[model samples]
Target: MQTGNLLPLVLALAVLAYGLAYMRSRAVAAPLGGIRHLKSLPFYYAARASLWCGLPALIVLALWVAFEGKVIQGLVVSSLPSDLMPESEGQASLILSQISNVAAGKLDPQFVPPEIAQAGSLLENLRNQSQTFKAVLVLLVAVLGAAFAWSRVAPNINARESVETTLRRIFFVCAAVAVLTTVGIVFSVIFETIRFFGMVSFWDFVFGTSWSPQTALRADQVGADGSFGMIPLFTGTLLISAIALLVAVPVGLLSAIYLSEYASKRIRATVKPALELLAGVPTVVYGFFAALTVAPFIRDLAEAIGLEASSQSALAAGLVMGIMIIPFVSSLSDDVINAVPQNLRDGSLAMGATQSETMKNVIFPAALPGIMGGILLAASRAIGETMIVVMAAGLAANLTANPLESVTTVTVQIVTLLVGDQEFDSAKTLAAFALGMMLFVVTLLLNVLALKIVRKYREQYD
Candidate 1:
């Protein structure tokens, strides 16, 4: 049995252990006139038995799978003659790849030296032995854990307490992992950004007006120096996002208000799901629509109106992005409006307020926090959108307020910078991290500002 097959077998063993423990617990409690005499329910005892039968075995299996390849590679490398021993990590990696290919029969032994061929044979044998041992060890641990838990299924034991404690520990570990992972990502980006700043002056990258990042291969080449200015990108990002919010906010909010306050339940039922279907449409499909349909229409319309518009323009991307986020705003706002207390509506109505007045003064005020949250989410969606911008806005990074201009955003630039094989030492590659850090900072500031506004409004409502 291999590690993959052992996983299902371990689960099967856990199920068997649970049944046996459950029956035993019932038997022990039966003489005492029912399960009421047991320290915990039979369910708890069975659950504890299942945990004992599965958790340790899974841990061992995970450890084996994680370390098995590395351990085998180290042994094979160590067994090589001094003349064949790899001098660096790169050489070791190359040797390992060749050995792997040879062992898998993708490369014939005749194509490799005798030492490498021997190492391949050893690698295959060691892997086979490791799999066999791993299966046996995992099964042995599972049976031992099951037997131990089965013996402990007594009336005096608190199986529920033990199971709860284990679950609490698991939850804590999961939360810690999430927090640590976020911290790790932030630190990694910060470190790379610092490295990038060392090579390119912070003032130049931040304040330079030019948006080029193509460094020449030779010093004598034309335009050897690359510009790492981010102003144009950030400007385009905000311009597109502002346009998207303009189109999305009022339309989405108004629709949500009508759906929640005035529309019949049957209409709401028919319309809400259909509106939300926009959110389910794939972004690539939206990209294709924007590229093939919207951009050309905008360009031709602008021309007809005696205005110049790029074939790919900010207006087209923003319009499409706004349409995409309508569902997000509407769905969230409708839920929040409906969640406002019914008493407030009745109170306003009893005071002789009209339906519109009641909505504006009572329900909307009460649901303002949630409504703001929906708007904020929509704004974020617009800011982070890349596919529509790439297809319709063009990747030009022009620092213009005009919606008919060709433009690109920070996200599109970042994707372009990191598209293919890259060395981190180069400013072009590191520039992506710089852009990312700026975007992160701007987003954090937006979130903080939104929260402060929300808090102020919330206090007024309270």
Candidate 2:
């Protein structure tokens, strides 16, 4: 078997071994003696043993899987006859691939030399021996570790407490991993953005009035001067988000109000799922719907009103994006609205307030923070949306407020910048990372602010 295909078998064996060890440990320690029982259960001991035995071996196996081919190929190439070495790296890779296939008893149609066959046989034997040795070593280590751990289990052991502590530590480690991953992603974006800034001044990137990323690569290339203005992209993003919020907020809020306050059990059950279905529809489908259906409709309507509209316009994209985000706003807002104390509504009713007055004056004010939090979340989603904008919004970065005009967003710019074959180090390519960092920072700030507002408001209600 190929090295790549062996990893799953190795992982499956390790997992199976862990399960068996756990069950064995449980069975061995079942009878609890008076006042001498373990502080932790037998299962905890088993799990701990399994973790120690399996985790390290699995990590090594993964690393080996990732780099084993490269290491082995390098060794093989270095040992190859000088005349057999291909002149081009591409050709060398092809030869190596053929060698691998031949080693697995798959004949290469292009080059079936006798020497190649011999080399393949030798490599296959080495691979098989290496795999067997590794598997045996791992099995021996795991079994020994489990046995040693089982031997240590005693009546005085605090197995339950130890297990609880271990689990807590594991949860904390998992949390740390999530946080570190986010930090790592942010820093990676920041580093690349800094590189982009080095090529173009920070002010030019931020406030320049024109954005023409298409620049000359060669000195002789004329008409190569490109503008780095981001004003248009920012404006387009805001415009689309605004249109979406306008479409979504009222409809979503009203739907939330009806669902939470007035809808019967049957209606609530049917309507909630239907609304959620909107969220499940893929964004790519929305993109085509915007481009094929919504854009054309908007253009025809504009013509009827004696106004001009492009086939691909901000209004169409924004409208579709808004429709997409309705669930986000409505679902969250509904929950928050429902969370408002029933006693407040009861008191308002007793004081002769109408339902509308109570909702408008008391419930809404109380739920405003949470509602704002939901809106901010929706806005963040709209900002990051790509496919719909790429399809419906034109690529032109026009810094105009007219919804009928074609415009682009930061996301669109990022997509365009990185779409084709790209050199990672180029200013154009790195600009995507800079835009990403900015988008991340903006979204992060909005989330933090929204959370703060929600917390303060929640404290007031408490």
Candidate 3:
């Protein structure tokens, strides 16, 4: 049976187990004058039965599904003749792909060697057997667990403890999965970054001014040697992010203040959602807007002002990105400003302070740490943005602080480096990981600083 089809069956069986256990628990309690005489309620007994019925079966199904493909593939590879065996991991992967395509009838039998065709046959047969065995095993386990729970559903059994313990374990497992995933990602990037620094000098990547990463694939090609300087990328990133922050911070902060403190309820209700709708706008649409609308306008404006600007400049992307990021800043700041206790405002007003003075001296000061945290988070968002940068800023790694000049960010270069078929061993490909590491470090520092600022100035109130 397919795993998808088997899930509903397991759920139905769990429901049936619950019903049966509930009845048995009631029967045990009825003779004792009510559920009051039982060790736990009938609901707990039923819940325990349902949990045992479903959880073990789901765990089995999960394990089987995770390893089924690899196990079957290994068996099929082993069945191949020794001479037909793959030499390397890549060869093995290619061989498995061919076998899978043939098994699924996506490839013709006559196009491949007899060994692969036979392996395809074995793969299909093993998949069928594996699916049948998995269903039988899962069903058997579910029945056994349900039976055990039913037999234990007596007046003396404290099924509540068992159910709560199981749920606690499940929660712990979920938390562990999230933490392990983050660890895995960091380690993967770290290993690749280490490999990258082996091929390219760390000082060259960090300090060199040239930013070309186009190493020739063959020795005869010109520019086989490439510059790996990252200063240009970082400069463009900062220039664009600075422009974005310059536009976003004042505008968003003021809007948040107006909505939270000054605006009427009706206007605040209407305008807040409208402003936040910008956050929901797809980044690709923002990219198109940056490319088609903003970039051209900036170029023409720069030309009219007797200033040189690229057709795609940092200013265009930064402006559009700032517009995109406004909601992030405004929403967070609005909530934080609103969270300042109403008493603070009343107390300031009672002290003969004007509204603006009250806001500046009391509310804004109270919310300053949260406001700063939100701004830094928005800055991180602007720095990590890729689509707008790619669309409006041309991919010339010119080390310039000029917003009107064409420039690319670290993210754009990372995308360019890993866009298509890439050999990981090459410095060009590995450079993406190195850039990612640097980006991570910068964002981490920003977040840490935000945390420090928040903790240092945080005020607690009843």
Candidate 4:
């Protein structure tokens, strides 16, 4: 059966199991002068039975779904004649694609060899048979588990313990899955980065000034040698991020202070959510704003001021990105400022300090750690942003600190490297992974620093 269809059926079976076990629990308790005589509640008994009916079936179904394609493909490949067998993984993949295409009627039968046609037929048959067996196995397991749970429903059975243990294990499994997924992503990037390093020297990538990643397909092509220098990309990233932080930090921090410290309840309530709506605006919209409006305006302004500015400049992207991240800083800082002990503020005021004085001397210092954390988080968001940089900050890896000039960020270059039809083995494509690894490292360091600052200051307050 299809997974979607099987899931609903399994859910229905679990519901049935719950009902049956609940009735049995009530019936068993009736003879002992009420449900109080039972070791656990009827709800616990119902939950335990539902879990028993669902978990085993779901586990079997998941495993079967995960491995069925690989198993069937292996079987199909093995059935091919030795002379027709694939010699490499790539060849095997191509054969599988052809078989799949033929099975799906996307390929003409007469266009391929008879052996391939026969293999496609076999593939179809195996898929059908596999689905049928999977359905049967899942149903049987659900029934057996439900039956066992039904039999175990007695006055002395501690269904609560069983249910709690199962839930705890499920939670642990979820945590493990999340951790493993992160590990998998990191290792995948690491391996690809290693491949990239093999093609391009690490020192050249890190320190070289040029940023062109275009490699000629033929030896006769001009400028065939691609430069993988990341210095310019990183410089642009930091330059833009600095401009964004310069705009965001002061404005957001001030707004947060006003809302949390000085504003009345009505004003705070009116302004906070409206300000936070900036965060909900789609980044693409921000990109459009930066590209269509901000970039042109900045160029015109710069020209009026007797300075040159690119039509697409870091200033434009940074300003818009700063505006976008304002809510992040404001909301977080406001909450942190509000979390400072009321007694601290009251004590400061009673000691004849002005509101501003109290805020500076007590509240601001107390909330500094959390506010710094918020700023760092906003900095990370600004650094990692792609759309605004792409649309407004032109993709020129100019190693300049001038915000008025066109420059591209690491993320922008990464996107540029991997956007279209590109071979992964090439340094151009693998450079994306290398950029990703660098970004991950940078963001990790920022987070670690933020955590340390927060912890150190948090201890003082505690």
Query: Which candidate leads in TM-score?
Result: 1
In model 3, the runs with Cα more than 4 Å from the true position are 459-462
Quick one: RMSD of model 2? 3.8
- Residue-pair clashes per prediction, in order, are 0, 9, 0, 0
Error of 1 at 439 (Å): 0.8
lDDT of candidate 2 over 1-462, digit per residue (tens): 444655565556456655665665555556654332455555666666656556556566667567766776776676667778778987887878777889886776346766566667667776776677666665566566555655656655655665577679879988999999988988888889999998888899888879888877875787465677778888999999999999989999999999998899899999998997999999999999999999999999999999999999999999999999999999999999999999999999999999989999889989988899889889888998989998999899999999998999999999999988988867778888877877777677878878898888778766
Considering only N, C-alpha and C atoms within 3 Å, which residue pairs clash in candidate 4? none
The alpha-carbon lDDT assigned to residue 248 of candidate 1 equals 87
lDDT of 1 by residue, 99-216 (tens): 9998898999998999999999999999999989999999999999999999999999999999999899889989999999999999999999999999888999888777999877
Q: Comparing 2 and 3 by TM-score, which wins? A: 3
**Model 3 over residues 41-61: C-alpha lDDT tens digits?**
999999999999999999999
Could you estimate the TM-score for every candidate?
Answer: 0.96, 0.84, 0.94, 0.94
TM-score of 2: 0.84
Instruction: State the local distance difference test value for candidate 1.
Output: 0.93
To one decimal, what is the Cα RMSD in angstroms of model 3 from the true structure? Answer: 2.0
What are the runs in model 2 whose C-alpha is more than 4 Å off?
A: 1-36, 49-53, 66-70, 80-130, 341-352
lDDT of each: 0.93, 0.81, 0.93, 0.94
lDDT of 2 at 31: 62
**Worst 10-residue stretch by lDDT in candidate 4?**
216-225
